[model samples]
Structure formats: structure tokens, C-alpha cells
Target: MSIKLGIIGGGVMGEAILSRLIAQQVYRPDQVLVSDPQAQRREVLSQRYGVNVTSDNGVAAKADEVLLLAIKPQVFKAVASDLVSKDGNHSSASETLPMVISILAGVSLTELEAAFEHQPVIRAMPNTPATVGAGITAIAPGKTVTANHIEQAKTLLGAVGEVVEVSESLMDAVTGLSGSGPAYVAVMIEALADGGVAAGLPRAIASKLALSTVWGTAQLLQDKQIHPAQLKDQVTSPGGTTIAGIAELERSGFRSALIEAVQAAYRRSQQLGK
Candidate 1:
């Protein structure tokens, strides 16, 4: 509605949020500002979204009421330094600082608060599906955040996908599950395609079938609000091919492998945070 949002990176995730916000009419392109170190990226986003773009992170940070930190975690410290004064406070002389929402992976609220010097911070973990407006994001707020701050954060993130509020302690689990889930689903799709090819289908047809099956099954489960097991049982008859396939999957420990994968990712996320 107004020119009040600033994003610190113009990368894929950053641009995804920007595009979705505009598509949802939550914010207009002219109302949003973005910053990227790459001049080409800045120009591209400006041309693509009609949003103001600058090479100066501080300029974007100072110009907005809400700041979205979409920069890579490895470069967060350097970028943050540009937004703060020598005393580690917002460089602006104004008493109030912008509410910050960060999508940087493995960065905890404690680290963000420290970097921004006690600014209200919301840490969000959103996966790649957000690029297409089908993502789910988990958000955790810092100690200084208020109810209003939470609403603001949700409104911004909800433009792209579903939002879940979680305690900071469970963020690593969220990171493991939905945050890294797209890769797991992609692997599953590829394996399904390969299986179909092994059974004598053309590669292109196999790939399309696998992708559509996954998409349809997901839609069905969501639309019906039924457990996956219920759906599996519905398709598995006493002597049907589905049961034969199910047996093979069980024999291969498919479910357990997925569970272990999520657990491994959770542990890795914790390690990265440390």
C-alpha cells in the first residue's frame, strides 16, 4: 500500500517474496526497495519488478519500516555491519528501528539480535517452493518482539505460502522437515521416474507421470484431510499391484529412510547454528 518494505538481497528467495507480495496485492512494486551487491542483479530486479533497487544495504534498511534479510548466511555479518553504526546500533539517529525478518539459514534470533543490537527479529525458514507460491514457512520471534511484530512478520511471509509460528527451540526440526523437504521430494520424483523407466516407459513419459502422480497425491491428501496411510490403504487391494509395490517399499525401509534423513538434517542444522 505504501513504500515501506526493504529487502537486503535480490536473490531467488528475495525475489520470490517480492513477486508474491506484489501478486497478492500486499505491496506494490514501487512501495518496495531492494539491495544487492551485484549491479546486474539490482538492475534486473528493478526492471523485472519495478521496485527501487540500490547497491547500498543501509539505504534500503533506512528507507523502510520493515526489513527483510534475504542475504546468504555466510555473508550476513558483513551486510549487517553496513546497517549498524560503530556502536552496533542502527546508524540512523531516529529512536525506532525497523522490524527485521530474516530468511537466512542457520542464523538464530540470538545472533540476529546481537548483530542488529537488540532490534526485534523474526527468523523464517522457507523452502524453494516459495518461489512458486506453494511453500510453507516456520517463523520464530526474538525476545523483544511483540504481538504486532508477529502479525507483521506473518503478513509479509504469508504472501508467499503458509506460515507456522514455532518456538525457537524447534526451528532446527522445521529446518530439517519443510526447509529441506523439497530436495527429498525431488529425489523421490527422480527415483519414481527411474523406476518407471526400468519398467519400460519412455524417459519423458516416466518423468511426467512421476511428477503428476506426486502432485495429484499431494493434492488429494491435502484436499481430503486424510492420513497418507489411509490413502495408501485405499489404493492397496488384497492382491493388487499397489500392495506388491508397498511390500517392496517396506522391505527397502523407505519410511524409515525418510525419517532418518529428516533427523540427520535436523542435527546438521543445529551444528550449523552453533
Candidate 2:
């Protein structure tokens, strides 16, 4: 059966994109197909989203339009092997080849193209916050991809959050920064909440305060289009509490620590790609 969108995984990230796409009416439930090995996952997706589900990966891989790969990177090769026939072909000769978009981290275009044969491939890096629809994703296209292929990918990924186009060379850096950024931001919020507790706030109140403060600060920076240093200066009046906190953070090398964290993560992404 022909479908508009084929999804090769029904995991958290896949479900997030699928739910958003359906809720936004980008694709009707009838036009989508999801493939997962677990019967429970297939059942959950079918019942919750009212979309077709299958245990066979090849069925979804041959979709009439776009195919999304949301599975873990470690299993990509093994799962991709399941899509190929004995003749080493996945797509029907008469059908329009599907555009393949992979959200699997560290799986290079070289590997994907080799597996998919002539299909246009786009590699993407998206963070965990995508589950909540507040994430950002960066996509890099393969040699065979055209502008239309990219716009189609943006539409699919945009269902979850913002989409950015970047060269494959910078994908590892994207992974280190925005791709793993949610964890860093979460840690900062958690630490801030702990600090509030140390200063006499209740745990629940501190948590809420920390979360709101970070979120509001981000919104303010984005809306106002101001530099972070400018925001810092505005809050750091002479001998004020904000300045005192800033001094402590600076003394503890907070900024450098974050920078180093991204660099370290970038290095790790490179290692994984190799």
C-alpha cells in the first residue's frame, strides 16, 4: 500500500514528530505508516494516532513520499539490512523514490546513501526537548538531494520544532551544541534550583523559580534580540545581588565550563561518527 509518510521507528522522538505532524494536519492519519518491531509499540501508535502500523520495515521504507529514520544509530545498519531484498533493491522500479530523512546521530550520508541506493538522504540532529515540541533540529543533505527535498524535510522536522540547514561538516558541532543542549540547560536549571534551596526556598518553589527564570530569560533575549552580555549588564547594577551572583559564577568559571562542555561533546560526536 502507498503512503505519504513512512516512519521506520515508533520510539519517543518518532512519536513526537508523528503526533505533531498529525495535530498540525500536515499529513492525514491515513497517509502515514509506522514500523516497529515491538507489537506493543505498534499497537500504541495505531490506537493513539489512528495510523497504519507494521512489523516489517520494508513496507514503510518504500513509502510514496518521505521516509523518516528515528531509530538509534547503533542499530541503523542492522535495521537497514532488513529493508533490502535479495536483489539488493528496496524501491520498486516504477515508483517515485522516497526522500529519506534520518534523525539518527553520527550515521553519515555516506552510510545512508550506500544503503538506500538512489534515494535522496538528509541527516539530522535533534535533541530530547523535541518530545515536548520545544527543540531545534539541524539537517544536512546528501549530494542527490534538491531544494524541494530539503523543504519537505523541513516540513517534517518543523512539526516538532525549529529547523536549521547546515553543512554536513558542521553536523558534529551541531550535535555538541543544540543537539545535546537540552541536557546542559536541564543541568543548569537543576543546579540553580539547588542553589535556591540552599538560600532558604522550598524545593518545589525553587524548582519552579529556576525553570521560569531560565525560560523567561531565553524568551526575553530572543524577543528583544539583545546580546546576553547586554542582559547581564542591565541586571548587574553596582553592588547589587545580581552582580554578586555573577561574580560567584564567573569565579567558578561557569561560562568556560559550558563552552568546554560543548567542545567535549563535539569531540565525542566525531568519535562516534568514525
Candidate 3:
């Protein structure tokens, strides 16, 4: 069965999802409804994808089976108030309320449910790379969500990239690890490129090598199914260059620094949600 999908914002992330959906033809453009206050953004979406666009949040909220709250967490309460007020007259329990999938970072399921009046809420953390259809999304369902709701969330998230299911309690950790993980990885890639440049490689070539190295290493980890330590050992001959660099990194406490960064992010997520 075809599902009606509603997007309740037209910011970068919301537009990214819309663009990917259109590019992938996951759903008919006409089936997607978007509401955003920004006229320019709405015009861009409507002109490019032929998706329905409106300034009224209620119009978007009422038009679809799956509603994505793509607005920022700071403004979410106001948006949720509007949705709940508009839903005041909706009384068909047999017809499920729209499955609310929120991509607002650090917003908990309880906060979402409370804001939207106990709607079936799925809180998801998707990274910025979703704009390129290369994101990892983590989904955590609220107490009111059903099995069908979870599957629906997965299907929608999977349209963009890989989707992982995690306990709502662990969602903060996911936010720290994967949601904010891209920036950390980007920093490492930049540092690697800098090192290549310092080693006399041209800047352009060094960048390409750094990115490819990271990508290839990730693929090896996934495809080889060997532990990362084993892979490192395989690359590091006794007293070899690889081992020397690894020793430097170990001395610099790279692993410990990463661990602390993730923990900090997790704590920040928890604070933001509260």
C-alpha cells in the first residue's frame, strides 16, 4: 500500500529528504506534502519536485500517514503545539494517527509524545550526509509506537541509507557516535590529507588519497569481518611505517580522545533532550 508522507519543514535536512525521495522515486512526487514558512524554499521544492507545498503546518499534518518533524528542536514545541491543536477534532482511533518521525537532534520520545499529545512517535537521528543519500540513521520508537510503526520508520529511513534500530535509552549514545560522528571523521580525513601534503604530495592528490584511504579502510572493515586490531596488525610490519604512525597516534591518545568526545556528545544530547 502506498503511504502518504508529510514533511513539516523546508530547511536543509527536510529539503534533502525530499530531494532524495524524488531522485530515488521512492514515492510519487504528488504524494509528498511539505509545509514550511520560507516561501523561497517551498517554491524551490515545488518547482523542482512537484511536491505539494503549504505555509500551514496543519495542512501538511492532515495530508499524510507518516509525518516528519524536520524542524529544529528549539522551535519544535511551538510546531508541536500547532499540530496538536489542529488534531483536536481527530477522533478516529481505528484510523491511526499519523506516525510522527522526528529528525530533530536530542529530542526524546517522551518529549515528542508530550508535545504532540502522545502521538505514535519515532525519534530518529540522521546525519548531515543524508543530503547526499549516504547517511546512517538510528531510530528509536516511543512507548506508544507499534511494530508496524517501527517498520514504517525503518522503510522510510532506509530510503536514504542504512538504518539501525536501537533502544530509546541508547539513542543518546547513537546521537553521540553516529549523528555527530561525521564531523569527527571529517576532521580525521582533513588531518590525513594534511599529513599527505606535508609528505610532499600535491594538495589535490593528497585530498583524494586521504578520502579514498578512509573509504577503503571502512570497506575493508565491513567486508573482511576481521577485527580492526587484526587489520592494523596485518598492515603494520615490525618497526614499519604503519606501526610508527600508529605508535604516534597511541602516544597522542587518539582512541581515548575519541572516547571522550563521544561521551561528551552523549551527555550534550541528554541535556538538550531534557
Candidate 4:
């Protein structure tokens, strides 16, 4: 049987995409294939998703129409070397080269094209929230990619959450923001929980409240389509406790700290690409 999708890794993010695609009925389990070096990982993915699994990347490269490159950036070159031959060519077994969508951080489209050689390549940055089918992925296409390729990429990724099309140049910023934003949000939740605990709430209750507040606030913002400042103004009455807390947060440079964190992460992402 011809494979519809080939996944190059079975790690958390890779599994997230695979599971989401299957769960959303984008692709059936038998239509997809996964390649992982670890025997345990291959077995787990096969058992969990009922997809064909292989230790050889070449099998994925040769068999599938579309490939999801979710391997770590550090091992990308080595993995690509295994897929292509010494002559810098893809397998002749497939009439056409596979369209590749890479979720590997800091791997540029140019680098992907160089490795794959004349194949369509898309660079995507998806956050950890994808594990829960709540990720927002930003994708940039290579020169050779067509409209159909972009649509296919979006269709597969959209299963997880939102899909945003961007130029390759802006990918690092996307990486810093959405790709790293979950950690920032997690920190904010922890801080909120800490504040509740300081005010005499039980740790478990505080944590639950903090998590729920964050989740609820996001849902409210998205559902209402209202600006955050508008919501803030609505909740913060004159001389109220909310206003007082807001004032303290402003005085403590909360917004500035988050901005700097993204900037720092962007710089780190750029360095990794080099």
C-alpha cells in the first residue's frame, strides 16, 4: 500500500501531530508511516497509532508522498544523510520526491532544500500545546513548493490547532513567540498560584485556580474576540483589588520581563540556526 504520510520522528511533538491527524480523520493509521531509531519508540508508535514503523529513515523517504520531519535539529543532518544517497539524490523508487514539512526548530528552508535536493520543503514552528491539540503552527514554504503543498501542510497541521502562513524570515520571531510562549504562560500560572498561596489558600486549590483562570481567560478572549485591554478595563474598577494588583504588576515590569524573555529566546533560536 502507498503511504500518504511519513513521520521522521516519534517524539512528543511528532506523536502529537500524528495523533491529531489521525484523531481528526485527516489520515487513517494505515496510510501513515513513522521512522524512529529507538526500537522501543517504533514499537510504541506502531502499537499506539497502528501505523507502519521503521528504524530506517530511507523507508519513510521512499514510501510516503508527504513527510513530516520532526527530528531534533542537531540530528537532522545525520538523518538526512541517511535518507539521501552519496550522490546527493533521493530514492528513485518513488516517481516524485516527497513533499516535506519540517517542525525541527532552527532548520531553515534553504537547509532543508539542500539536504532533500529539489524537494518541496516547509519549515513550521509548533509549540508544546500541540500535544493537547491546542498548538498554533507558523509555516513558511520553500521556493519549489506549490499551492497544493501549502494546503496539504495546513490541512495536516490544522488538526492540532491554528495554522499561520509566514515568510521564512519571520520564523525565528514565531519561534520565540508562539513556539516558546507556552513556557512563559506556564511561569505566569505558577506565579499566580504562588500569589494565591501567599494569601493563605491551600497549595492544591491555588494551583487549580491559577490554571483554570489562565485557561478561562484565554477562552474568554478568543470567544469574545475582544482586546485584552478592554477585558482588563472591564474587570478593573476604580480603586478595586484588581486595579491594585494590576498596578503592582505594572510597577514590577511584568510585561517588560515577558517581552525580554521572547527577545532572548529569539536570539537563542538565531544562534542555533547558525
The best candidate by lDDT is 2
Clashing pairs for predicted structure model 3, backbone only:
none
Worst 10 residues of 4 by lDDT: 85-94
- If candidate 4 were superposed on the true structure by all CA atoms, what would the RMSD be? 1.7
CA shift at 172, candidate 4, in angstroms? 0.8
Q: What global local distance difference test value does model 1 have?
A: 0.89
> What tens digits encode model 1's per-residue C-alpha lDDT throughout 1-274?
3558989999999999999998888888888989899999999998888899888787777545788999999999888776664443375435577888999999889889888764788999998999999999999989889999999888999988999999999999998999989999999999999999999999999999999999999999999999998999999999999999999999999999999999999999999998
Error of 2 at 71 (Å): 1.1
Worst 10 residues of 2 by lDDT: 85-94
Superposed on all Cα atoms, the candidates' RMSDs to the truth, in angstroms, are 1.9, 1.4, 2.1, 1.7
Among all windows of 10 consecutive residues in model 3, the one with the lowest summed lDDT is 88-97
- Give the TM-score of each candidate: 0.95, 0.96, 0.93, 0.96
The per-residue C-alpha lDDT of model 2 at residue 74 equals: 94
- Candidate 1 Cα errors over 4 Å, as ranges: 86-94
Q: Please, what are the lDDT tens digits per residue for candidate 4 over residues 1-274?
A: 8888888899999999999888888899989989999999999999998999988787777645788888989999898877665432364524577788999998888889888776788999999998999999999999988999999899999989999999999988998999999999999999999999999999999999999999999999999999999999999999899999999999999989999999999999899899
Candidate 3 residues lying further than 4 Å off, grouped into runs, are 1-3, 87-96
Clashes of each: 0, 0, 0, 0
Clashing pairs in 4: none
Candidate 4 lDDT score at position 271 = 93
Local accuracy of candidate 2 as per-residue lDDT tens digits, 123-237: 9988888888888999999999999999999998998889999999999999999988888999999999999999999999999999999999999998999999999999889
